[model samples]
Target: MNTTTQPTHNTLFITCFAALVATSFCFVLRAFVVDDWGHEFNLSATQKGELLGVGLWPFSISIVLLSLLIDRVGFRAVLWVAVACHLIGTTTTLLATGYWSLYVGTFVLALGNGAVEAAVNPLIATAYRHDKTKWLNMLHAGWPGGLVLGGLLALAQGGGVDWRWKIGLVIVPVIVYSILLLRQRFPVSERVAAGVSYREMLAEAGYVSALIVAALIVIEVGRVFDWSLLLQGLLIVAATAFYAWYTRSPGRALFIIMLIIMMPLATTELGTDSWITSLLEPEVVSMGLQPGWVLVYTSALMLVLRLFAGPLVHRFSPLGLLALCSAIAAVGLYGLSQATGVAVLLAATIYGIGKSFFWPTSIGFVAEQFPKGGAVTMNVLAGVGMLGVGIVGSVLLGTIQDRAIGHSLAAHDAQHATQLHATYFTSEKTGVFGRYLALDEAKVNASDAQTRAVVDAVVAGSKKTALKSVAVLPLIMLAAYLLLLLYFRRQGGYRAVALTQSPPAA
Candidate 1:
């Protein structure tokens, strides 16, 4: 377990980084092609959000489940599962016939993504135990690297190439990473090497964290299958009760607070990324620019910044950096809500820099603060973030767009709005928030050019409003990070906890 002496350390790190790059390939490709799927499947905005969310939320299931078992099962085995999932999910998506097929494909892909993180996060954390935060940030550079590369590749394909072909590109990195990693020797996790018992690791997360994750799973799954309220509640209770009985702890207070903070943080970063291409489509297209370029541009910035995070973490400390980034992100999101023409790129630059460190730094914080929790603490934090963005953030943003468009259309032209509602907005969808009517894509397409123009204008406004609505998320995160900064300051100063040392008292 002496990481410095491990011969495969650098190669394994590269392989892990490549695996994450493969995951981001799936993400960026899906983000770019979501509109194509919407058109082909005649999907509403909400349905499109569901497609995007499926590409994310299912990540939680595989990551959380696999994290708990990875120590016993080994990293290579879990990565092999990820490889299989990638191939199968890509194949399914390529052959998709409609919304349901696309949903299944994305859901399976998310599972593969989760598996990759479950293996790589702890693998890298253990590999660079002495410099966990710095190395983790360096490792996560692959995410934005893939985003930049994948986004550019998709953009290069232009309007002529089929979306299926773009999706198939995910297999390239998959093949490369699999070849590099499958034959490599895996390392013992730091927790196991330190003789941290299974019970002790479980205590690091405990029942409170378990309850939050369990509840989100139940709620999201219940929504999908139309499960009764009673069933969902019972499932949540049973799951939490079992965990509490076994762990006999409420979880550390700071870990729980971090878990809560993850929701808004994930929504601000991943959720915004999920919708950015579509949200800015009208503005970008009007300026004769491709919407995907904004994503590519932002990702390139992130890629470069993350590669240099070691210095930044040193200067600001982890919590201080998070607090600073949260405020920057809030400003950036608000700027994006109002930016137009060439200014959009400027806004995106700020937003990209702000979000660049959020994911990796958060992981670093959890890994440093709760090393005894091992993969469970790190991956659970990631899983909950994905769950939050998938079930709530993505879908809620779509709902906001739909509602705003509906309201805008009504206020603009009441008679026309009523006519359009009767014709196009015929689908009634219910989500966690409540029931709302969504515009049917097929019906919208069948409308006259003038009607389409009017609808487009309304949609453009609504998209901006959606961005504005989401701007609040980062503000919430800023407040939370500030409070955490205060809490750490009162305790003397923020410091990365070591495995041999005890974590701060709850």
Candidate 2:
């Protein structure tokens, strides 16, 4: 009934295009806002984490809201409303000189960004019905694509522009997309096309349940993305027995549980897919080179990879490609955790390439299996990813850093676990005492104070770094997703074997 070669009339294309812009805007805003505000806010550790989480928070909230709203009004209305919110939010950020204002503005921007996803994700399924998963991958890849642009600008040119100018920069993309959507005529959802009821639309996101399962897995095993052998063994037996009774494989149980483990992993991976610019600062500092520039180069490659993702997914089978990519990412993240200097910079770049396709492939896999609920799945995946950034950053990574290098370094990032008031991230701000508690270790190595100073320093630093760098959890999760991708290759296209092959004759 519908046929169009170009995206000109492709509702998904136009809406996805807009979604791409919105996604890019959200990450870009998040990427730079942290750096700019860090300078302006002189923020405490808790404030900084909260500030960063603001970008992630609105996204999660928007996902739930969008899931419910799209079932009612459909996408066009949601898309426009989202764009309007982003515009207002971005514009208001210029007025922010304090915490609450900045929070409100960033949240509004995320709201709009979240809304874009609500529309485009389901739109991808509805539009490209056959390749819903592939298209969804392509569509969601827009996020890393946006991050590519966002990070490049923020890291490379960030110093020259004021935060106001940075916020202003989004206006161009916003205006261009608004114009494109205006010119295009869109369509109703796949549910509308097939005459399915709204109740079914709600159930479409089987992957959302899957995401919850994966989120739990990540929490339980502490393995970012790999399946716990124990969990998998239990699932295999359960699924086999369950399938003996019903026509449909009861694997959905495993899928849901998997999300509990994997959703957080995926989200953590993406959040940390950020530029290497924020690598911890040593006590002795200089202006000559900042890690941000390293991030710029890494982000540039990320953009380039995303642009080619359409073809890559076509060739490698999305899941296989993701596994390979994630393996590369795992090495990168672990390496970053342990390495330093230019070597660390190089590792981050390697991590970047590995990270390039993790989300796209995973999102694509979900879209293929759970077309109707793609938006909800995307939200869960995306939302959990945001929260992963917070949790791993606030909890996991901080603990590791404290134990390994917190006391050795000039900064002791932890010191909060000692208090009953322990929230997500509180130690990174407790002040010079925290710093000296760790730094004084070098001076007192021979003094009677050595034992107490070092012990105190490690605890505090671990806490601090755990919160500071939990974003790495997602990067590690990417590796886990990659393995899962290999397992699910049949469900999507692109097998593991093909990942190693060169592109076929065009």
Top candidate, metric lDDT: 1
Of candidate 1, the 10-residue stretch with the lowest lDDT total is 497-506
Give the range of the ten consecutive residues with the poorest summed lDDT in model 2: 495-504
- The whole-model lDDT of each prediction reads 0.90, 0.54
Cα deviation of 155, candidate 2, in Å:
5.2
Residue 472's lDDT within candidate 2 is 51
Question: Candidate 1, residues 38-156: lDDT per residue as tens digits?
Answer: 88888878888888898899999999999989999999999999999999999999999998899899999999999999999999999888888888999999999999999988999
Question: What lDDT score goes with residue 310 in model 2?
Answer: 70
What C-alpha lDDT does candidate 1 achieve relative to the native structure? Answer: 0.90
